[model samples]
Target: MSNALRVLMAQQNFLVGDIPGNTQKVIDGANQARMQQADVVMFPELALTGYPPEDLLLRPSLETRVGQALQRLCDEVRDIYLVVGYPRMRDGKLYNMAGVIHNGQLLGEYAKQCLPNYQVFDEKRYFSEGDQPLVVPINGVPVALTVCEDIWHPGPALQAREAGAQLMLNINASPFHIDKPRHRTELLRERARQAGCPILYVNMVGGQDELVFDGGSKVVDVAGELLFSGDHFQEADYLVEFDSASGRLSCAHPSEPHPTLEQSVYNALVLGVRDYVNKNGFKGVVLGLSGGIDSALTLAVAVDALGAERVEAVMMPFRYTSSMSLEDAEAEANTLGVQYDVISIEPMFDTFMGQLADQFEGTARDTTEENLQARCRGVLLMAISNKKGYLVLTTGNKSEMAVGYSTLYGDMAGGFDVLKDVPKTLVYRLSNYRNSISPVIPQRVIDRPPSAELAPDQTDQDSLPDYDVLDRILELYVECDYSADAIIAEGFDETDVKRVIWLVDINEYKRRQAPVGVRITQRGFGRDRRYPITSGWKAGV
Candidate 1:
């Protein structure tokens, strides 16, 4: 028996429905592994069809295409043992299966024993659970294979250990939430100790729609010690060397920690934008730069993701917009080196107000006038996006999104919301961080009072609490999932807690129509939180 075995973990990105493309990615990873003289190479979960193919698994032809792609990958990569994931249909039942191929043939296959069905996962809807565990021998080493959710359950790892498997390889397309890597490492360590096998955890790294997969793939020893970890939010192919005789495994060192939450969130948003644009073949991004922190931050992120030339920032100011706001926005665009346009909303606003003058006789101009300015800007931005083939990026932050502070079909009209999960406070922090790297956002933009400039002498403080207080309250209610009473019990002012919670609760309808954003928190307004828009149940504080 060989004393030493080498394994390669391919943390590559795959596009959904691109069967031929994904198959080539697997083949490329395997070829790279063979060039390095590795015995086996492992890919992420559903690599053959891309992770979370979502409802694509429902189509019969899609499943057939995935099956053929899997076979083709197996035939193409003959020198090295390859573990590839795909959806398989057998006996009129669908299963999430992993194929073990070697010497140009399929050696064995394993269905994912456990299916995740909660919080952005609907695996149970597409696949039936496997009752049996799979243990296959690869070059004298007994290898146990599992899909993404399978290792989360104790049964599979324990069963594989009982079956005398020497090592376990788990493939995942796990989505990124803040601090998810720490939790994953802790779980992998526990699984390693329980299974008494060096575990190789290979995870897909890229953005797929609302989901951002942080790579950070890792290997842990039998004693629950981390052997190596890959980079986060990036593609990586790492090699793990296992001494079968000594039962020891080691690899290259893990990457440096992400500098800050803002940096991490920034990278996730950039990757999300890049993938969504490039994968979908969009030319660029267009956004209404309101000279506010939200749009400034969005522009910085867009410039980073699509390059300055591909991003266009437009200042659509209304009559109430301050001169300082225009200057600051122009400065930011200049710093970013992107194309900037000034399309004043005065003409459009005049047309709308002229149309509404008769209806406005009884109703003293309240939010209607404010909304007119926003709608005009939205129309002009959409016009540019429609004509220029650029995806419009909405700049609303989570705090505004939580409270319906943004106008639906106005500033909210866009192909993506870059800061949808980020709060107003974090928006400021990230803006400062971006400026620190290269003072792109004017200092005045970060320091000045935030406003929609929809009305005379308007400020965000008029409607919402100070961002510091609002963000704390939101963090408690949204992220911690605390009731108003629970938040008050945590020593917050009862009225403050109730008001914030009430806003979040009342604004569900608006959020439902908002564009998707990169989710950096545990409870983003996206798929993570699914409150009913018409719910009467509020936490009575």
Candidate 2:
């Protein structure tokens, strides 16, 4: 047996339901590892079937196809040890299993023990838990293997240590949230120190539906020291050498951290949008650039994600839109160098008001008139999407989406919403970051007051509280799941807390109809949050 062990980390993206394509990715990764003289190559959890296959696991034919794909991968990649994640049906139960393959033969398999059931994860619905931990000898070094959630608990690591394993390798398709990488590192270090073995954590990187997997995969020594860390929100294939004599593992180089939180969030959103579009077979994206903060940020993210060539931004202003807004929108469009269009909503707005004038009788011009303008823009954006085969990207933020501040099927008419999980405060931060990159968004766009521009002199503050104050209360009530009283006790005014909570509770119906967006926080307004839309409960502040 050699005194040195070389392993390759295959951090790549996989398209869900594309069996042949995913199998080819595994084969290619193995070939790359073998070229680097690596003895083993590890991939992310469920790499063969793609992460979060969701209900696709229920179909028998899908499982058969994945199994056949695995066999084909085994036959295609030779002389290199491969640890690939896939779903396996054994006996009468289904398991999230990792297969150890060498020389066209299956070495052994270990199923994931801990199945995460909370926060965008529902593995318990599709897979049964595995109790046994398996350690295999590769090049005379005992290597213990576990799936994604298994390492989160102490049981699997303890079992591996008791099995005389020298190193622990975990394959994961863990999704990303703000500060998730730091949390993962802290947990992995603790596990390594406890198990008294070097731990290698390999995570999947790419966008999967509402979830984004930032592959900051790393290795920690028995003393809980980081030996290597991979890049976040990008894909790479790299090799690490583990010294069997001293049980020390180190990568050739260290990965750099993202420049800033805004940079990290922006990159995540870009990757999320890029993979979502490509994986879903969409050629491009179309968005309504209302010359507002939300739409501006969405356009920046879209241009960065699919490239300016694949992004199309339209300015659909009504009679009430300020001239400054029109100028700012055009300047931002020109700066990003993407295709832009000016589709004035005056004709459509007049048509709608004419049709509803008789019905609206004495309801003197109020929110109904304001909403008509929004609906007109929505029709124009959707029309372009339908005609050009582009996916409409909605541009509402979480703060607005949470409180019914946005009109349903109006600005919310799109296939994807880029800022659905971002709050208004973060929107400002990301906009600033975008400008910092190259000053693509004009300074006036960032400095000017925020407004929907649905009516003359309309501003977000007119209907809602200040963004800074509102976002703080929202973070407490929504993200922290705090009660109205709890929020008020946290230094917020009682009326403000009650109003924010009430708005959140009453707006579930609108959120249900809003387009799906990237999930950057622990609780996005998607599947992670499910509330009764018809509830009559009120906050008792």
Candidate 3:
């Protein structure tokens, strides 16, 4: 009977479907834990296949590759017990599983219970649930194991306690969303109390496509007090010493202070852009740099993620482009040390109008000219992307994308969108947050009214509701799924509510083709919320 046990939590980032590389990470983590004299090392969920492995799990050869990775893990891990997560194929069914290994021998295994199929998760599509609980022995101590979704519900946690386990280890690849950390902590505390034991939660960190997993891994006592937590949005290993006899565990170091909402959201955007560009083999990124808040914040995130050397800012000006816009655009690019380029769209706009003169003989000019200005810029950016091999990052926010305010193949044309799921209000907050770090964005830019600058003396408010008012309405309608009458009943103007809801409902076609972006809200466009393009449904009470 050992009185003290040490655990090394390997909070790591893994690329999806990289079995060989991910397997090597497990071996390396085990070696580090052994060298530090820790008794065991734990990894995040699906560490061997990265998170969500998505359709990669359906590959015919996936089983063979996973088996080899497991063998490699068992062979390389020597002194410390290695706890890792991987997708398993058993009895003609796929499962999300975790295993314990030591001295090239497989110990016990546990399959995930709950198969999440909501929001950003579709686990049921790839994994079958396990009904039995698994508790194993290590150094004369009873230890329980569970995968990502297993601890979300009470059954598995309570089952482990009833099965005579003194400690429980839960691994996860949970991605980031606003206030998700607090929600997870509450659930963990409740589970810990139910089990009457301390629990170790190892979570994945880093960006995958539009999703960013903030590690923030931690442990809690039976009383629901937090023992300690790893750094948010970082990958590192921390050692925890436990006394099985006393049922006490403590981390050697104090946990870092929790990040503010502004900081966390900003970090999520930076990580999302960085990994999407680097992992996909893009040389760098290029974006239109207007004097507006949206592009200003996007540039800051781009530079912080990929560095000034990899980001380029292009200001495509038109007749409506203000001198203030030009000055501020250049000033911000200079402040951030990013490469700046200026191209006038007057010629392109004129050429298109001239070419379409005969076809447009009967109609008067309206948004067609405004849209042409945007499309010209989009074409120029795409051409630059083709010649220079840099990905074009669009800068439309969720507020505009929610309605039919953005132009198709114009403002929405790009390889990726930085703020596709970010609300207009959050964009302002994040911009202020970035400036707080060092005041890079020009002060006047943040202070000025937001405008498309597509026409003379035009401002966003000319056609849309105030951002503060509009953003809240969007949350109620788009995020919370409140009907028009319900929102109107909440003391909002009926006209405004009806107009906003109409815009959102009628613009599904545009959103369907919009580029993917980071999802920071509980319900974001793309993966989190799905709506039909041709629905006959109306927004009513």
Candidate 4:
């Protein structure tokens, strides 16, 4: 074999704030790398303390735990060059840092210079900026070290090259959003080509809250050609061999193909649901299956995530519920092999109507009555969730949630929303995509028109714009950050554009209180995009 400094990149899933467990993970990775005859074992950012420790960084025991964890690594890792990330406290200051250790000796530490403070990152709040550059020699090859955000700009890569480094190793905990993989590939190429050195980027995978880090770890050559890559949506340990003598890198496995549009979004939802339920210690998940595309898609995602035994679908039908809906809901449950139950809300609805009869003596029936129907279903789902210890999964999609189409304390009542970031138009696409895999969703469910069934005969279009048009407007206004006039200029109907903007603006309060969900897009509702709940600003076309 040619003389090469073998590097092992561990793309792992780390639970935030689990110092002991995370430390064990690092030890295991180092051992695996040694067994593979690696010279360096490189880990993702914050591999020791986990990424985005958030307020856990403020814990009184935070520094103590980090020190103990580092000591454990120093004592245990003796043969391989171990590069691991952890939060550092030095001179009464905290910095995002990575340490180089070998043969039970702490060689040096590299504090992260760039602390990202946008989207899902708030590194500035906890970490003081590190200005020094760290370059360590492994097998006589100078390998420069950098954190996640450092490589995003040009300074760190150039600095590493200027420091006489042969290759750069950057550790990351970067979360996934739509189109991010491609964007990252291009950005890494630009950086490598500019620095004139190969780069190995290791990213953590797994879901944390709304953030899902798709461990698409990769290594590119000096000319920016990809030499190695890993699969998406799984925690993987890829042993990549980089030849320092001949500048040739190789892997045993070819790069796994990137997922398609629907697959990518669906995988994000699955990972998000799985981690949220499992990490929070929920027994399972319970959700209302209204026989509509939104609920059907959510049910399928839940089953794919937690398995049929852990997911329960309750069809809370009302007087207006159709026979077709009942059949479709049952068919979906049977196809998915999930625990299914029927809970009729007619009696509950009558009781609530009876209780409010005196107060509603004069007002004619309107959204109030429709909202009551939704609330009745919500109450049933919540009660079952409480008794069974299953977290409630809300099925409202982005198109509905963006507008005032959803009722407060009604359909919005749930522990987590699986489709909070998914638009209504995408719900149908995802449903079809899931069916294509195993045909779990009923064909009729995908073909039928969507309705709330809260009224005698109600279609969503009667209350709001068509989903195709609504989703487009939402993408422009919400995701693209366009003004009313800007969207109208895109050739949308003036009236539809105005109404959609108005609804999204007025519904900010409801969304602020809504449950969190998976974020597949760059500008999802939670950390990525934030608007004032109460504002006097008006959009004009």
Candidate 2, RMSD to the unseen true structure:
1.3
lDDT of 2 at 158: 95
Q: Write the per-residue lDDT of candidate 4 for residues 449-520, one digit (tens) a residue.
A: 789988888888887888899999999998888999999999999999999999999999999999999888
List, residue by residue over 55-140, the lDDT tens digit for candidate 1: 88898698679768876876788788899888898788898998899987888889998998877888888999887878998878
Segments of candidate 3 deviating more than 4 angstroms: none
- Give the runs in model 4 whose Cα sits over 4 Å from its true position: 1-3
- Candidate 1, TM-score vs. the true structure? 0.96
- Residues 487-540 of candidate 3 have per-residue lDDT tens digits of 988888888888999999999999999888888888988888889998989898
Worst 10 residues of 4 by lDDT: 1-10
Question: How would you encode candidate 2's per-residue C-alpha lDDT over 6-34 as one tens digit per residue?
Answer: 98888888888777889998998899899
Best by lDDT: 3
Candidate 1: RMSD to truth: 1.6
Local distance difference test, candidate 2:
0.87
lDDT of each: 0.87, 0.87, 0.90, 0.89
| lDDT of residue 182 for candidate 4 | 81
Q: Which residue runs does candidate 2 get wrong by more than 4 Å?
A: none
Could you give the C-alpha RMSD of every candidate to the true structure, in order shown? 1.6, 1.3, 1.1, 1.4
